[model samples]
Target: MKAIFSWLNKPYYFNPKPLYKLKISIYHGLFIFLFLYIFRPFYLHEFDEIILPYTIGIGITAFVATFLILYLPALIFKDYFSEDNWTIGRNLLLMFVGVTFIGVALWYFGEIYKEPYNLRKINLLQFLSYTFLVSLIPLTFFVFLNEKNIRLRREKKVKEIRELKKVQELNNTEKLTKEVSITSENGKEKISFCIDNLVYVTSQGNYASFFIKKDDKINEKILRVTLAKIIAKLEKYPTIIRCHKSYIVNTNYITDISGNARGYLLKSKVIEIDIPVSRSFSKQSLLRLIS
Candidate 1:
């Protein structure tokens, strides 16, 4: 039971690629069509009197319903459906909602074809229950496939970061000798330091705070500048990269990285606090830190 709960809360992928969506939709439609033909539920066999039309109608309706349920909201709510916060439970919810919608569509279409010749037919509720039952296999299959994909991606990324860390460690010797300069937004205040001395930069509202490592101690220098404004200037120093909306960090100063599914938490040797690599920027930040 504990393991099941952990799996439910584990991170999962959503809003798959367009080609994958289309392929899945097609398979769903075909599965529905095949199930209908084999089971002949709700007097569908009687519809064999005019089988061609009903067959086409069922196939097309299933295809369109699956496509809309799976693809439309992804485009509309692109930012809301990020992989960082998506969980297995959320994905299951999405699948259940999709199955419900597909059931509703099929119920509506089946109503149209219910002829006076045969008044014997299942009600909407029963049809929907049937849909849910029929849908279980495919949804479960996808959950496993998607989880495997995430595991594969994480493994490859971890390997890439490991190799890059080795190269950067060697290059960091020269990087420590260079000096970096940053100025305030109004151009009134400025600070300069050797690359090794700077630990991280954080901003709140319009004030940016620079955390500097000196004599094995952490010191802070504040400047009246937004993080966005200061970030461009810091780019000249390759080790300094923005990891989140509120923070920029020197990758060379990062002592440990926690690979949480939501984001990467960075711990620095000189700084006591944990810096975050946000969902929106984690991929790019990792790329920057690695290369």
Candidate 2:
């Protein structure tokens, strides 16, 4: 019973496309029509007739009514039944109750109309049982097929996103491999390092402090250059992003990001100190870190 409920409660089981719903309804109508036409389940004793046509008609009408009934709520409360917000158990149970009630009501009225003033021939228990049984088959099939399609689409989208990320990461890694030269404004003093080893640069009044990783330790080198000049020179490197007025960091070293009332702070795995991320640069810093 639990397994059955789980299967029925899968995503997209209740909410399917209108075309798919129409196709399922048509399939259901055909199944019921054929079943009753061949078996002749209900009998009218007074008329001494097998109510085959009426049974088939009632089955198709009940399912069509059920489909329309389900559609109204979905249309009115779109967000409630949206993919992210959907509650499988609640939605499926409501749908089951609704379809069953509609099916039973159709069967009841169908019997009364076929045999007016002849209540004895109309067995409510038998009518309900048959209605529920017929309803169950088509509903189960529709849910299974809808859930399978949804799962396949979700998996395909996830795979595509992962592949795209892999390609971007590869390109970023290739860019990081190149060496960059930083020179002082006077053009007399210059320093060069592989983009990967450069951790960060901090402004220190008239000079800029460059922190580069060598032999697993951070080596600080002070050059006679302004932060503005360094920023202009390193603007071509995508991974090296400026996070604050006094600080520019290589995103490859960022381990964590935390925010407070003041603003955001970025932590680097290679550096012992935490870098302040200004409100102006916070959004761009995060985007570069992730990208």
Candidate 3:
């Protein structure tokens, strides 16, 4: 029952789920109507004396029963379905059984209302068996739809994952100018940093900070991507200057560069950070910082 509801409620982005439910409900109602109408002659043969009234009552019951039969299991299993595959199968099974039960019930209702209503006279087992067989048509249809839904969901997920990977790859590619390798004393991890998107790299006691540009804004992420390894990575880019032992600056965004024996300054409207240029790299760093 839970599975049946889940299959029915599978998400469809463009078409709201309620609209789909309404569409399916109407179709089921019509299907039940046709099934009853087609078998009206057989019902009449057994209850000829009160056929008119019996037919009217059965029609009304069938109409209401069709939607109830479809909705009941949906309400019951509203939360039980968790897995996608099971949800699809359960929904189909519930609908199949619901329709079969309603059809058989309508048959019994017609017979019971007639003039010589002999409760013991009818073959209840045979009626149930026949109804079960008849329900296979709609059951098959529901199964087909369920399979299709699963395939579409899988495809959609695959597409979304592929797009996310591309975005991550592009971000990595843009930082290509900085080629820094990272190694941990724990020896569990080692990797390289691509410098294209790098805004700045900062050092902590035993860790490093990697600030990269994402959506035109800088976000600081800690990487085992060490400061020394990061310097090794940026070796190819001469413009990259070590401003401080603790800080490295991408000179591309440097607006003003000034320093004496104390430290160096780099300024932009959004940021102002001092770059400490060591005696060894001070000349080169100062030249890049100014240029």
Candidate number achieving the greatest lDDT relative to the actual structure: 1
Please, what is the whole-model Cα lDDT of each candidate in the order they appear?
0.75, 0.67, 0.56
> Model 1: per-residue lDDT, tens digit, 1-291?
999889888876564588888988898788777777777775576676766667667888999999998898777876667655678887887788888898899888877776644545678888888787778567778787768676666656656776666666455556556777778777788888887777888986679888888888888999888888777877777787888888988887776565544445677666788776765654445756543
Candidate scoring better on TM-score of 1 and 2: 1
User: Against the true structure, whose TM-score is highest?
Assistant: 1
TM-scores, each model vs. reference: 0.66, 0.45, 0.40
Error of 3 at 69 (Å): 3.7
Positional deviation of 150 in candidate 2, in angstroms? 4.9
* Local lDDT at 127 for model 2: 69
By lDDT, is 2 or 3 better? 2
Q: What is the C-alpha lDDT profile of model 3 across 102-185, one tens digit per residue? A: 767766774566426763344777666666666666576756665676556545543454454345422213334545655665
- Which 10-residue window of candidate 2 scores lowest in summed lDDT? 282-291
Candidate 1 collision pairs: none
